[model samples]
Structure formats: C-alpha cells, structure tokens
Target: MQLQELTGYGAAIVAGLVIGLAGGGGSILTVPIFVYLFRIEPVMATTYSLFVVGTTSLVGSVSHILRREVDFRSTATFAVPSFVSVFIARWFLVPAIPDPLLELDGFVLAKQDAILYFFAFVMLFAARGMIRSSEPKADKSAPAEPPRYGLLALDGLAVGLLTGTSGAGGGFLIVPMLVLLAKLPMHRAVATSMLIIAVNSFVGFLGDLHRNDLNWRFLLEFTLFSTGGILIGIYLAQFVAPMPLKRGFGWFVLVVAGYIIVQEILTSRSML
Candidate 1:
C-alpha cells in the first residue's frame, strides 16, 4: 500500500478514537482525510464520510441506548424530519447545484470548492462550541415541559440538511436543540444526538448509494479501522479527562478549517 493510503487508514482510526473519547465532532475530520489523503473528490468523499460516521455512531450509541439514556419520543420527533431532509439534500439539492457555482472575470468557484467552504464554516462553528465553556446544564429534577415538536422538527430539518450537504454529523447542532427544545438532560441530549446522527447519516448514504458508484472494499476497511479505534478510545476514556481533550481538539479543528480555506484559495489561484 502507498504511504498516503496507510496514513489515511491510520487517520480513520484516530477519527473514531476522537469520537469515542470526546463523543462527537471528530467525524468531521473524515471528509478532509478522504479528500486530501485518499485523493477522493469532494462529493464522493461526503458519501464515504456518511457511511463511516454512521457506522461508528451506531456503535457508539449502543451503550447509551442500553443505559436507557436516549429519549425515544424526542428521537422520534427530531429524527423523522431529519431523515427526510437528509435524503432530499443528498438526492436532490446536491446534484442540482451547478458545477462551477460562481465565476468572475478571471476566477471561478467550483462546486467542490463551495461544498468544502461550507464544510469549513461548519467546522468553525463546531470548534467554537467546543472551545467555549459548556452550556448550562438543564435541571433534571424540574418537571419536564411538553416538547415543542414544531421547533424540534424544524431544527431536525436544519441539522439534516447540514449533515447531508457537508457529511459531518450534526451533533454540535443536535445536542443544543435536544436540550432546549426537547427538554432532554445534558447527558441524554448527547446520547440522543448520537442516535440522530446515526440515522441521518445512514439515510444520506442511501441516497449516495443510489447515485454513486462506491468502493465498498476500501470503505469497509476504513470503517473497520475506525471502529477498532473507537473501542480503544472508549477504554481509554476511563482514565482521561474529556474536557481538556475536547478543547484541544477544538483548537486543532480550528486550525484545520483555516488550512482548508487557505488551501482552497491557493488551488483556485493556481487554476487561474
């Protein structure tokens, strides 16, 4: 195997490890790894990302499901709309976008660049949430309010759209809405977000399967390495403090997002 391919697989394991240790945000790294290291195109990279993130998240959510931490009602409410939106984004919206989305006198913005630009902004948003102090925890002892199903559905659609378009699990967006709109406790919100991410990502991948010719062997190999890393990370979590790791990871993501923008700009300029 080429060194770059080996490194890509290694990065996949590290991506899974981060998700297992910190619980979310790590899977966003998958798209960049696929695009840069594996030399996959941006659109197909998102497809590969959906499958990897979905499978790993499905594995990660199992513990939370067994512990009875996931709110089934909230999951149903948030996930139904999310599933529909994700499918639509993957099947319709993405394909409908023009190849060269924008062009000026001497410069052009390709569809792949637009997608990566959106993904980078999403990373920036995720990084901000991670670097900041945690949001105030909801009072668990307080009586639960009736969930605003309307708002929950809306947030679900938004998150699904973002996930389908960018291939990042929308946990950063999902957890907060689950807490505020679904009235789930912080732990439950995090747990429930995993389920939502798993479902949405798989749904999005289904669209890709229908539209794209996929490399199943390579995908399975990458996902297997990632799963192994997640298991190792779960074991390591017992001894490590997640908050510090999360903050550091956030800074790393910030740097990566910046790098993507700079790299894209340089590539575009070279094209000119």
Candidate 2:
C-alpha cells in the first residue's frame, strides 16, 4: 500500500479508538484528518466522513444491541424526527441558502464553513453535556407518563439538521437529550445514542450518495481501521470504568473543538 494509504488507515484506527472510548468525539475527528492529514478537499472530506462515521456507528450499534444495552423504542423516537429534518435540510434548506454575492460583507460563507460551524456548535453542546452532572433517578421502570412527544420531536429535528449538514451522527447531541429529557440511564442512553447516530448517518449518506461526492478509497480505509480500534476500545471498557472515560472524553473533545475553531478562523481569514 502507498504511504498515504497507510497513514489514512492509521488515522482511522486512532479515530475509532476515540469513538469507542468516548462515543462521539472520535467520529468528529474524521473531517479534520481528511482535510489536514489526507489533503482531501473540504467538500469531499465531509462526504467521506459521513460514510466512515455511519459505517463505524452501525458496527458499534450492532455490538451494543447484542449486549442488550440498546433501547430501540427510544432510539426510534429521536431518530425518526431527526431523519425527517435532516432530509429536508440537506435537500432543500442547504441549497436555498444564497451564496455570497460580491455586494455582501467581504466575509462570504463557503459551504465548508457553514458545515464546520455547525459541527463546532454541536461539539460544544456535546462537551458541555458531558461535563454536566447527571442526577440519577431510581426509577428503572418506564415512566408512568410518556415524555412530551412534541419536545422530543423538536430535539430530533434540531439534531438531524446538524447531523445531515455536518456529517456527524448526532450521538453527542442525542445521548444528552436521551438522558436529560427522556430520563434514560447513562449506559442505555449511550447504546440508544449509537442507534440514533447510525440511522441519521445512513440517512445522510443517502443524500451524499445522490450528490455522488463519496470517496470510496478513504471510506473503506477509515472503516477497516476504525473497526479494529473499536474492538480494542470494547475490550478496554471491560477493565475501565465509564465515568473516568467520560471525563477524559470531554477534555479530548474540548481540545478538538479548539483546533476546529482555530482552523475555521484561519479559513475565514483567508477568505477575507
């Protein structure tokens, strides 16, 4: 294999390990690796990242399901609305946004910037959610009263729009919502989050497919390496407590967010 191919695969493994350990942060790294490390065009990298993240999340979800940790009903509740919103956003809203005309502020937004800004905002939200203390309630049984469907649907719609546009699974967004809003426990929330990510990612992938923007070589390499790393992560989970991992994951995400912000600043400046 070529040196670049090897590097890409190695990066994928690293990304997967992060995802397996922390849940959402690892997948978010895909775009950066593709753009900075692999020298992929920003537009194409976003598309590629979607496929890679979607596939990895699918595998992770299957494993979680096998362990009987996933809550399908809750996952569907979040994913269904998310899927609808993402489809509309990707197909309609995204296109409708006018490109910068010469008359506009010297700062014109590229499609890439729009996507990156969306990603950074989601990451910040996810990081904040991770750091917040969760007051665990003792109720194991399903709530006597169903949650507000309209509110959950709203969460799904917002998450889906970001996920479709940014190529993220919305796991970071969904996990917190499941726990805080749906009142699921942490582990179940994680498992259900994976399922929601998998569904939204697949839906996003379809939109990318229609655009014919996918880069198969990068996708395959990323999938293979990430899968290996995920296995390693799962094994490590057996020995490590999730709380420490969660804390560590939050810091790691913060670092990534900082880097993305700097990159965006540079990109935006260059456009000036």
lDDT digits (tens) for residues 43-155 of candidate 1: 99999999999999889889889989889899899999999999999999999999899988867889999999999999999999888836556567988678788999999
- Candidate 1: minimum summed lDDT over ten consecutive residues — where? 131-140
lDDT of 1 at 22: 63
Off by over 4 Å in 1: 133-135, 139-146
**Candidate 1 global lDDT:** 0.87
lDDT of 2 by residue, 5-69 (tens): 67777878877776665556577778777876787766667677777877887787788899998
Q: Tell me the alpha-carbon RMSD of every candidate.
A: 2.0, 3.1
TM values, all candidates: 0.92, 0.84
Evaluate residue 55 in candidate 1 and report its C-alpha lDDT on the 0 to 100 scale: 95
lDDT of 1 at 66: 92
Model 1's TM-score against the true structure: 0.92
